[model samples]
Target: MSEVLESTTTELTPGVRVPLIGLGTWPMAGEEAAAAVSRAIANGYRHIDTAENYGNEEDVGEGIRRSGIARQDIFITTKFNRDWHSREGVLTAFERSAHRLGVDYLDLFLVHWPNPAQGRFVEACEGLRQLADDGAIRAWGVSNFKPAHLRHVLDAGLTVPVNQVQVDPARGQPDQLAFHRQHGITTGAYSPLGRNGDFMASPAITGPARELGRTPGQIVLRWHVQQGRIATPKSASDARQRQNLDVFGFELTQEQLAAINALETGGPPRLDSDTFGH
Candidate 1:
């Protein structure tokens, strides 16, 4: 059995300590998803990220069971769809997701998208708060929320623990990250590595990879955790899974970090939450 890596965590709430790095399960389903989760756990990962929209919660749950790790030993995060953007609807979504994941409670639950057109995300946030207050979940957050959406949530006097977004070296979302910091909201990065291997070829990333003798992906994940952000990087290959978790052992120089940070293209994120929804 592989030794489990010691977790480095960031506080999402007063008492909630979320691992700095996690496993992302998206665009994978069925037995393949299950096996990946199982392999990840055996290789030292304690964080697993999934969503209802991904349609693989059952498989992820099966993988957890196969790993023989106690439920409490792992941190699980899942997101709900827009159709459930209501006080009661969010509760219903939680019930269904918990049932599918075979877990009595969740570590963190996020409103998948704002779906601002529906005008009920606030109520959905209300539902999430109730769940968190009642111990149904450790914490609740939003995904794909722009500054405007988060501002609305805050204006309502609601506190957001985290905001999950697509962030990579190529599209760093500096403005979004700055807002999160100002609001004391933890930034959870999805797709932390840019869409393809193309971005990894940049000298900014490659230089560090070569100097440290680590793969470009490892360098990137290291850059993420070094900044105190939470990243969920998905990989089904056992070797990749192990490699992802192995990022904790090294440090990146400020110059190298800045070089990679400079890779941001200043382009709009791939999906605009304003007009996009499940």
Candidate 2:
């Protein structure tokens, strides 16, 4: 039988379709990050997610340029840092990000975190609106945002295209997912594979991996896909990078999916929403 890599996509904004699976460049920098990105694109990933804070935008840009993929064929996402949440600061930060990425426009630009305490989210969002109006970014959204914060933004009449949050079998975000669904906003899962060092050792993952003849990593990835959330898994190893995107060829049975979902504890998020001083 031939292996089939399933391709899924969700539209966070009109005319902006981001692939369900993409490469996340976090904690990766320098030449290694660039080479990993190049390998991922060569291995069939069309979407790439990076952030100004990642400090790898230049390397990512180099990788994309070397991938031989047309700029239009790739969906690039970058974020505005927390410190740069002010109105004037946002434009300057975005311009710097674009310059580093070597791109005139970003497919999706997001607010890295909601620092409401700074009392600048509203103004920052307004800056994003201006960028959208100027055609500098094709779409704009937020990451690590809670429902209350999202409501505040919406109440301000700012339409967010998507909300990128931490979602995985171990940390199911049903409320966040529902909120996005209710508001016509797409949800992106940043760490679909629970950062648990022993994620594969868990019965929740291993059991399904056994049934599907796949690795626990693949099982976790498929679970994210089966749940209909966009996921970006990060890896520096070429083998792991390939394994991360190798999720397309198999289908997890409903029973297997339920087994994985049953592992949800609604526990603390893997990423720190409060660390950014929001």
Candidate 3:
């Protein structure tokens, strides 16, 4: 069963392929988080996302070790927060994340959020590029960055390969996705399920789930994959983790996809990089 229902992958760069469905390790920590990682790997997830703010890097590392999978066989992504937005601070914080994750080279590293108010994200992008060049990280990207932030990075003469952010059926980010496509940046979604319980009640999501004999969460994730974004939906529950990873088996039709797209309400307490935080 595992052999037939394997996970799909996306290549961010030459020789760097990440599984499209990753186990997002946020708000999960300690031994509990470690167990989820191990379960995810055993269930066939090769990509895992972590962050300095998540405070679960060590546990994620422990899970990898427990899985008995070679470190090279897994793709690890860890992010640094705004506190490390400075040029020097970037590398320093990266080293700390690496040390905690117990790895020397990361498959993906990102600036967790664009600290627009600080005005030093460009420097952080350079720092990530240096880390990639130095063989410390295989690929580098940014998260939660708007078009302006992306443009700022590009104007500095660098075009990143990936941008992870909060994208779901509700907040599809159509304009931002178009901008990323024009620039050749792959968009990765964070809150791909748009929260949890209250989110699943939407008729747009439930209708597809019932018709396809899949869970609403699976329907949503399939939507992300079909539209060509790396979807990282976090779940500490082993059952839910495997359930989310099992989305590759089905495909959504054009009309069905459009129906789901029509569910966007445009109100979710937006977090704009331009005026969010420093």
Q: Candidates' TM-scores?
A: 0.97, 0.91, 0.93
Better of 2 and 3 by lDDT: 3
TM-score head-to-head 2 vs 3, winner: 3
lDDT of 3: 0.87
lDDT for position 61 in model 2 = 97
Worst ten in a row by lDDT for model 1: 1-10
Query: Would you list the rank order by lDDT, best first?
Result: 1, 3, 2
Prediction-by-prediction clash tally: 0, 3, 0
Give the per-residue lDDT of model 2 (tens digit) for 183-258: 9888888978867645568787897688778889898888887676788999877788888888877888888788
| TM accuracy, model 3 | 0.93
Q: Write the per-residue lDDT of candidate 3 for residues 116-178, one digit (tens) a residue.
A: 888899999999998888888999999988898999999999979899988887787788889
Scored against the true structure, residue 178 in model 3 reaches a CA lDDT of 91
Please give the RMSD of candidate 2 to the true structure.
2.9
Q: Which ten residues in a row have the lowest lDDT in candidate 3?
A: 1-10
lDDT (C-alpha, whole model) for all candidates: 0.92, 0.84, 0.87
Off by over 4 Å in 3: 1-7, 197-199, 268-270
